[model samples]
Target: MGDYVLLAISCILVNNILLAQYLGCCPFLGTSKKMETAIGMGMAVIFVLVMAGAITWLLEAYLLKPFGLEYLRTIAFIIVIASLVQFVEMFLRKSIPALYKGLGIFLPLITTNCAVMGVCLININEEYTFVQSLVTSFSYATGFGLALVLFAGVRERVLLARVPKPLQDTSIGLVVAGMLALAFFAFKGMA
Candidate 1:
């Protein structure tokens, strides 16, 4: 239990897939312009990441490993992640049209989000137990949500602030992201 808890914390903070690993920045920067969209995107990613982790772990352990098809891990993980993203998109579209629309094209873009695929690959490569992988995946998603939400708050404030013409829009966003990444790096020492 303690190990699992520690692993979760490590993934969420010290080894954040987005902040530390810098795997998925597309939606992070794209949807973060607004709090609602960032929240929606983050939730969608969390749901898909957890599902992909579980499904891909089973696939690697049972189907791929048994058949000595380990070489196809990348392709297999992407397929699993992509399928999960599609399912999420359809579910969101029907259950919550506003969120689906608010997310805009970012919903579909998650299919190619390397962060999900990276979590799947890491779970398999690390040889984590089923439960551990699930926990790690959830933690990673939580970290992503935490970052996006926090950054959204910052962006909302930045919108009203006076800024130099040269450092507007994404330029300022990048600067903030760099600072945020550095702040996340502070967690490394805590581990």
Candidate 2:
């Protein structure tokens, strides 16, 4: 139990997929303009990352390793991740049209989000047990959500602040992201 707690903390704060590792910046920047959209994207990522991690782990453990098919790992992981994204897309479109519309291109972009692929690969490469992989997956996704929400809050506030013309839009966003990354660095020793 204590080990699990430490792993969770390490993943969520010390080694955050977004803030620390810089894995999925595309959706991090694109969907972070509004708090609502950011929250929506965060939740969506959490769901997708967790499931992908579990399924990929199983695929690698039960199938790939047994048959010595390790070379196909990348292609297999891509197919699994893409299929899961498609499922989420269809479910959202049918069940929550508004959010589906809100997410727009960013939702599909989750398929390509490095954070998802990175976590899955990390789980396998680290040779974590099934439960450890699941925990790491959830923690990483939670960290991603936390960072996205925090950044969204900051970005929303920045909208009202007067800024130099040269440092507007993405320029200011990148600057703010750097500052946020520095803040997350404070958690490094906790792990």
Candidate 3:
């Protein structure tokens, strides 16, 4: 339990996927212009990441390893992630139209998010047990959510602040992200 808690905290604040490793910058910068959209994207990503990790772990342990098909891990994992995202989108559209409407596009976008696939690959490479993989997946998702929401909040403020002509949009956003990354670096000793 203590180890799990520590791993969760470390992943969320110290080794964040977005801030620390710079993974998923596309969604971090592109979808975070609005708080609502950021939150929706974060939640959807969390769901997809955990599901992808679990499914990929099982496939690697059962199908890939047994058949000596480790060479196809990347392709297999990607197919599983894409198919899972599609299935989730369809399920939500039919059962929860409100959520589907809110996250419909983001659901599909998650297929290529990189962060989801990255977590699965990390778990496989690290040889984490099933429970450890689950915990790490949740932690990675939490970090992704934190980064998304934090950037959304910063972007909201950036909209109001007066800025130079050249750095009004993406340039300023990059600077702000750099600062946030520095701040997250302060948590290096947390684990």
Candidate 4:
């Protein structure tokens, strides 16, 4: 139990997929313009990441490894992620039309979100057990959500602040992102 707690902390604060590892920057920057959209994207990512991690681990353990078909891991993982994205898209579109519309193109883009792929691959590469993979997946998604929401909050504030013409919009966004990443670096020693 204690090990799981540390693992969660490591994934969330230390090895964050966004601030620390720098995956999923596309949506991180795109969907983060609005707090509501950011929250929606984060929740969607959490669901997809956890499900993908579990499914991929089971596939690798039961299907790929047993059949000596490990070479197909990438292709298999892509298919699984794609399917999960489709399910999320459909569910969101039907249940939460506003968020679904707000997410727009970024919703489908989750299929290619490397953060999801990266964590899945990390779980396999690290040879984590099933429970560990699940923990890592949830923690990483939580980290991504935390970073995205925080960045969104900061970006919202930056929008209202006075700024030089040259440092407006994306220019300042990049600077803020750098600062946020640096702030997250403070947790590196905790692991």
* TM-scores vs. true structure, each candidate: 0.97, 0.98, 0.93, 0.97
Give the clashing pairs for model 1.
none
Candidate 4: misplaced stretches above 4 Å?
none
Clash pairs, model 4 backbone: none
Model 1: worst 10 consecutive residues (lDDT sum): 76-85
Candidate 1 vs. true structure, TM-score: 0.97
Q: After superposition, how far is residue 127 of candidate 1 from its true place, in Å?
A: 1.3
- Tens digits of per-residue lDDT for model 4 on 114-144? 9999999999999999999999999999999
lDDT of 2 by residue, 94-165 (tens): 999999999999999999999999999999999999999999999999999999999999999999999899
Write down the worst ten-residue block by lDDT for model 3.
Answer: 98-107
lDDT of 2: 0.96
The top-ranked prediction according to TM-score is 2
RMSD of each: 0.9, 0.7, 1.6, 0.9
Best-matching candidate per lDDT: 2
What is the number of residue pairs that collide in model 2? Answer: 0
Candidate 3 TM-score, true structure as reference = 0.93
lDDT of each: 0.91, 0.96, 0.89, 0.95
Error of 3 at 191 (Å): 3.9
Q: Candidate 3 — what's its lDDT?
A: 0.89
Candidate 3: pairs in clash: none
Q: What is residue 8's positional error in candidate 4, in angstroms?
A: 0.3
